[model samples]
Target: MRIRATAAAVSITGVLALSAFAVPAAQAADAASGKAAFSSASADATSGTTTTSTLDVTFSDMKVNNGKNIAVGTTNVVSVPVTYTLTHPADMDTSSDHFASGPLIYRGSSPDTASNMLISDDPATCTATSSTTMSCKGVIYVRPADGDLMNADAGTWNAGALAVDDSGDHTMQGGLGTTKVQRYSKLTANAGPEPVVKGRTITTTGKLTRANWEDNQYHGYTNQPVKLQFRKAGTSTYTTIKTVYSDSYGNVKATATAQYDGYWRLSFAGTTTTPAVNATGDFVDVQ
Candidate 1:
């Protein structure tokens, strides 16, 4: 991948400042010689070499995904937003064709040795606020279908910054910030009998599931707290009736007295590795 400043009018190729150290082999080859193509095998591997240097530039005020957990689903790409400030020498011309800069997030001890890392697919757009300071914005595209992520990759990840100058010298700074990657959650609800006698018992059941990157499927999310909520017909609000926990198979069930025509659904509060979700409401009639 190429690294470039937003204000630069020229898009330079053959320079892998942001990807030279930790990029996949295929991508590295494509960057270095522009002959190879990216494949699943290359995308699945995260091991690579490291290049470190001390430059006069510094990165600060970095934020990834707006400092929120990134929820990724199977078969879809998750594009994360990143913003930061770049401070460098007053005489340095970042807008020059030979200069490039960008941001990245990685999981592991360091960016160079990270088990997994994500770099911006596009160059960052930066606007100079002063002679030596710039405000930058960019994106990191996470493709789950490409084997870029796995179940084990969930949780916290560290952020870093990179840059390359006219002399072909590059520098990277790690431990700049952190963010979380989580699986997208799903919930389902079904209530029966459809028409019940007044004062009779109405049963509501549901299931909680989340994406499993390993199998590219959604699996049970068991033993988690879920809310059973009900909304009377003609009303726009739902009220919690009870709390239930998912079983070994991620099943949840609750019962309530049939007093009025209403809808029932399940709501999950979510965990660090999964996002909150609400099932579609199931309608029931009380006669």
Candidate 2:
């Protein structure tokens, strides 16, 4: 099952300490004893020193979602893949059960004080490449319905990594890289009349819409410029005929002289919060 860290839990400095050691429900019973001990040790360690400690560990070559924008719809859960290289002291055994690590993406300046964050549901799986080097892979799950994302959260997010040892010592690092989270966008076009006299005015209409995380629905992306293009029926080329801006209701309309049989469509250039989209061409016949 996919799990999310609550805002209250993730906003604290010990966020990584708790998340790094999280266990799946199925294994909770068996891990209960170990978890309790780790919690106690963590409390004792925090009482003696600051949470952020310099450790002989570093994360590099970190990549999130294969370096592409993460577009998420309203209902479907989005699973993002993350991979990174971890370098640590030769004596630190990262693959042991006593060690845990994971990657996270957040919108705020720092991971510890992030207003919104996404983290892997489980600890990363690491394979040893040498005594002190390893390759790690993990998945971060985003569920929009669970309030995991808001429309405002769509944009550039900073990547971060964290690791915790058996003794509750932990380190968190941010600014490793960055990734974009976009709202899925949709566009539609329709041209009429189906068969019109040569040189007659052909009206093309369309709408630009994008996912709204707040309501789990697609709403008008108003006041955005969209391109209207035409493709000759027999040819494979589409030339821009004109540029139209979406109205207050996200509706776009344009008129063109129909001189030949062709298809008409609308193309949106997109923005930081939304991905570019093209409407399937609507065919029109000229008599």
Candidate 3:
């Protein structure tokens, strides 16, 4: 079969991020949801007509579909971008209904039941970089009702691909695999006693937490170091004054002698499992 290339880009409405593997025996998503909308296979049937033959797919720099970290109001959309390169001995005619597809599921230490279906909205947009390699960027959405697929703390995940034949009867899967993880966090800060004596101590308190995908809750992120910084009034530079660690409940507290009128804030340097975060500035007046 002769390979033909077209520039078709998938315009997804919205999304989040995550991994891949053998899709469950049942279709993880609804009929019109995710890659399933265009995908024809489920966990039960992901292999080939010729058992020895398989397609080649590689992914790099995968992230939340919208390309942003997890935040309070957001992180609900179900999509992640998989920048990839596809290579196969067989020609992948973009003109055919057959293309790339899979599920972006949670494969962390304990996997989340929810998954995002993978699909290339526009197969034509996928490029033929060479006779045997094609470069493409596609999306996998967490889908309606599914939440936080990539919200793990340095969690482990993967992205799987398959080359569906033109007939759609044969599926050569496990094209390429890559590890996926989520590094996102949240924090809060507050300062009390708006007006204080210059020599008196001011107490600053805050909380640190990351998304808990399994229960969809935000619990305290324990035993993490956080820096307390201060900025004099009308200044843009913030100088670190002290370091503190979150308590068992991810709550943080520290006291500093007030010397000048300014803003005080707490910042978490974060860890491999969580992204760094800075609490909003809390302004205080020194009398």
The lDDT leader among the candidates is: 2
- Model 3, span 1-287: residue lDDT tens: 00111111111110101111112325344213434422423323222112222224333333333444322223465445655555644555543233443323233111112133234333323567677666666655442224434344244343443344332222322323434344447888898678998899999999998776555667898999999999999899999999999999999998899999999999998665576789998999999
- Candidate 1 deviant stretches above 4 angstroms: 1-52
TM-score of 3: 0.64
Q: List the candidates' TM-scores in order.
A: 0.80, 0.85, 0.64
TM-score winner, 1 or 3: 1
Worst 10 residues of 2 by lDDT: 42-51
Assess candidate 1 and give its TM-score to the true structure: 0.80
> Comparing 1 and 2 by lDDT, which wins?
2
lDDT of each residue in 139-227, candidate 2, tens digit only: 88889888788888999988877676654456667777899999999999999998999989999999999999999999999999999
Best by TM-score, which number? 2
Candidate 2 regions with alpha-carbon error over 4 angstroms: 1-8, 11-51
Model 2 has an lDDT value of: 0.77
Sum up the clashes in candidate 2: 0
In TM-score terms, candidate 2 sits at 0.85
Candidate 2 vs candidate 3, TM-score winner: 2
How many backbone clashes are present in model 1?
0
